[model samples]
Target: MQREGSPWRGLGVVTQKELSDHLSSARMLVIQLLVVVTGVVIVLVSLQQIRDITAEDPFLLLRVFTRSGEQLSFVFVMTLLVPLLAIGLGFDLVNSEHNQRTLSRILSQPIYRDALLFGKFLAGLATIAISLTAMWMVVIGLALSALGVPPNGEELARAALMLVVTIAYAGVWLALAMLFSVLFRSPATAALCALGLWLFVSILWPLLSGHLVNVLFPPSATTADALLNSLSMHQAFRRLSPGALFAEIVTVLLDPAMRSTQQSQLAAMGLALVEPGSIPGAPLPLLESVLIIWPQMVGLIGGSIVLFVIGYVVFQRQEVRA
Candidate 1:
């Protein structure tokens, strides 16, 4: 809607152009194909598994997101796919223009750099949202046709909320990728940096956290104070990883039976013993599930914002001389 003289004149046009490029890009198409193909395969196998496990389970639709073949759940698959897609979409967003000697030309237009950066980021996120929606609907439709079970209101609500969470989760990676795009001149290097960070945070952080706990608190000090300290330290360190945060959010949302986030395992067992007669396997109400995951969502969104702000500042100050 911006006019000729406005600084934001080209924002919408640039966003649409980028959106069209993403929709038509071969890489984007391949990523979406992989997601849909794997999702379809997983949902097919999971349906049979669910049938064998429980016929009258109320949350069968919800199970599609968390259940999969050979210990590879759909949510887990996204832990790999989402970040890769984000990185691919953004790793060259800025520097490629510089390499091609087009950045200054774009900057010479009646538009600010903010519009360009924001537009590109928004376009990447829109791509994620669109691709996720397509695959999510496919899974839900197939689950409905195969399972022959009607999803209740609550189940549908949970799925919708989880989709929103998926977009937000993708946004974090998009922001990080954009940050790398601003930092690195070479696209390959930016991608490597993002992928390396993802690998370390997802794989190595937990092991390091465990080692730290063991080194600081010996097995001999398994008493109350040391155990509490160790648990707190592990929690503190794990929260540093966005993957850990996203996983916790997915677990609580898709698994409606999840009540508390930080409750110790021993405390949970004690509570179970005390409430033996209470309702078993009951899903939490929708509002309560949102409340339980509020902090997780906040952390994720805040992390994305911080990364985006850093990218914004860097891009603004970056010398665009080509």
Candidate 2:
């Protein structure tokens, strides 16, 4: 039988309900508090270091986000924390309804499953976006108060792009958590699976990429070009993980003078120093930096969409009888 009306007939209603629940939930409160507290400490530490070393730097505000304190920069800290926040919010999204025996009843209403699933995902993403935006503003405010200098137009633009990229990174994990929730009936199992996958991608993948690259591209002693080829392949495997993609995108966006990705920046700069007429440490135009990391940005967004589609299909096929 053909269904009537739009698949998104009650999308707005479902979104509003879910968003309200997410924003008001105790779980959200804890996650936001943890992120905000850690972020503030890291930024403040970075501010002190920036003041002492780079007081005359033009991009002082950006350093507050990229500079490291106790070996942890705000950007790196977000890369680690964002995934956990996403997973916490999404790990039980669908399974909790099933465990409560409410899934069937919710479907019994006029709303289509499409709207229900999409709405929940959107609600989760919006919550993360709001939290990140507020934290970003707070960090900027603190930096301005300490450094006594406001960010220029380009610095603001770069920071905004970083925020967008971080949200996209969160979406990737949120979709993964929701996918596991749809696959498993128990919420604990869903959360465990989502976290296990995160550990593998964020921690283990980088460790193994070099080994895998060597196995695929083995060392070639005869040709000088062999090393470059191997390094490129290694970077390729590392970029498969969403964490690496996020790091690469922010590396260039936060540091205008950085003309190379993390993997190649040091080597590229060394070469520039020796080569006559080459300008080392010169900041690239904002547009040029965007162009360099554009592929990584696309990869992060694409990964989220792929994960969401997989979950959508699984949810659609499963039977939810009362």
Candidate 3:
């Protein structure tokens, strides 16, 4: 029979402890410092450019900020800095506990293994979400103050959607790091493995895919159509890389002025673009852009969840002693 009011049951205790630990750790301080440094740099760069521009429309200023920030600021932070931060926090989560012999004592408690793992995972996720939200607010505020333009309803909605996508992308890295931590006994080994995986997926995978395509389908006339057929496969394979997915999502979300210039082009390319007459039109709807990214987001997050579940099951079944 389950107790009605007990707080230390199953996963709750684990979640609470993990959250407490994260709150007290140097990990929190490091995350804060990174966000501050990155946000300040973005603001400074934007301000410098704003001074050089002659146009003074607030809306135009806002648009400039969106374009420049999306291309230079957000993409760099999300792709490079954020993944490193996530790996740093998670790469040793399990190994550190094991090294300190705390795992055996924790398992000796009444809590279930699932609870312990779930709590820690949830805590890590919460920390990520909170950190991201803070940085997002800073960006929005800086844009508003510097540009002197309030965000329209659609702009606000798109900002929210972008933030969610960013979090999901970061979560993939965090989960992968956790999986590596559980698989390896030493924290250093786990960290190295996680970083290696990140580098392969984010940087090397694209180059390898391009090389394979060149070698296998060498752009001959007969193979030209074959190359077109292989393009989708290449894209699908590249989608496995989170960096590619994140880039595609950012391209769609940040550039709202993209629409088909003409019906013929739309029919030919199978993508809508900004009409010729609407050079300065409102961006595509937030939901529509998000829909474009749905497949990539699902693939990355689904892969992460699958990996985490496998790690969880393996960790739960492993033997541990004091």
Candidate 4:
């Protein structure tokens, strides 16, 4: 029998309830605190290093995020921490409902399974957006107060785009965690699988992609064609990892001088041979930077949607018995 009424009838109600629960949860609070504290310390450290050259740099505000002191840059730190936050929020999203025996009860009401799943995802994404926005604001306020320099319109626009990209990056991991949550009944199993995948993709994948490329396409003795092919293949493999995509997007968005996302040995050689008239460090227009990262943005958002759809299919098929 066809279901009656709209599938999204109670989406707002479910989203509101889930958002409330997430906001009040101690797990979320602790995660947010950890991200905030780490970001602030890194920003402060980087600010000290950037202070001396404030006059020389036109985009000092952007530098606050991309510049690192002795540790990681704020942008890199976010790349690492945002996934953890996303996983923490979603690793138990569906399993916890099953464990508490609330899945059937919740669905037995006027709510459809569609509303419930979508609402949970929207709530988690919103929570991440809120946290990242607050972090960005804090960083901006600190830059303004410490450096007494205001950002130009273009700098603000670029930072805003970066914020949007970061949230999309978080969504990819959140959806993956939720997919695992739907697959496994045990929350522990779901969380472990999610974290393990994250570790492999974020840390191990980049290291292995080059080796895998070399194996797949051994360099030829006489020509650079095979070497170029290997380098291209390596980048393609790296882009499969969301972390690599996020890092590339952030690098270009934060620094307008960045011309391309190509980081291979061949790309470095190509850059060295650029014409003498080429301006290497000239800032790119905001639209040009967006064009550079448009594919990466699509990849992150597309990955999230694909993962969420898989989880939705699995959730719809599974029986929710009380």
Better of 1 and 3 by TM-score: 1
Candidate 3 lDDT score relative to the true structure: 0.72
User: Candidate 1's residue-wise lDDT over 1-322, tens digit each?
Assistant: 6545555668898899899988999988787887799779878878867877777777889887766765777767777777877887888888888999989998998798888999999999999899888888989999999988899989998888888888888899999998998899998999999989988877788789778766876556757666656666777778788877787788788888877554434464353312356565577788888898899899999999999999999999999985
Q: Order the numbered candidates by TM-score, best leading.
A: 2, 4, 1, 3
Candidate 1 stretches with Cα past 4 Å from truth are: 1-7, 217-229, 262-280
lDDT of each candidate versus the true structure: 0.82, 0.86, 0.72, 0.87
Worst 10 residues of 2 by lDDT: 266-275
Show the colliding residue pairs in model 3.
Answer: 256-283, 259-273, 259-274, 260-272, 260-273, 260-274
Instruction: Please write out the lDDT profile of model 3 over residues 73-118, one tens digit for every residue.
Output: 5565578877887898788888778889889998887766777777
**lDDT string, candidate 2, 162-211, tens digits:** 99999999999999999999999999999999999899998899999989
lDDT of 4 by residue, 122-205 (tens): 999999999989888878887788888889998999999999999999999999999999999999999999999999998898
Instruction: Say which prediction, candidate 1 or candidate 4, comes out ahead on lDDT.
Output: 4
lDDT of 3 at 141: 81
The TM-score of candidate 2 is 0.94
| TM-score of structure candidate 1 | 0.90
Model 2 misplaced regions, further than 4 Å: 222-224, 262-278
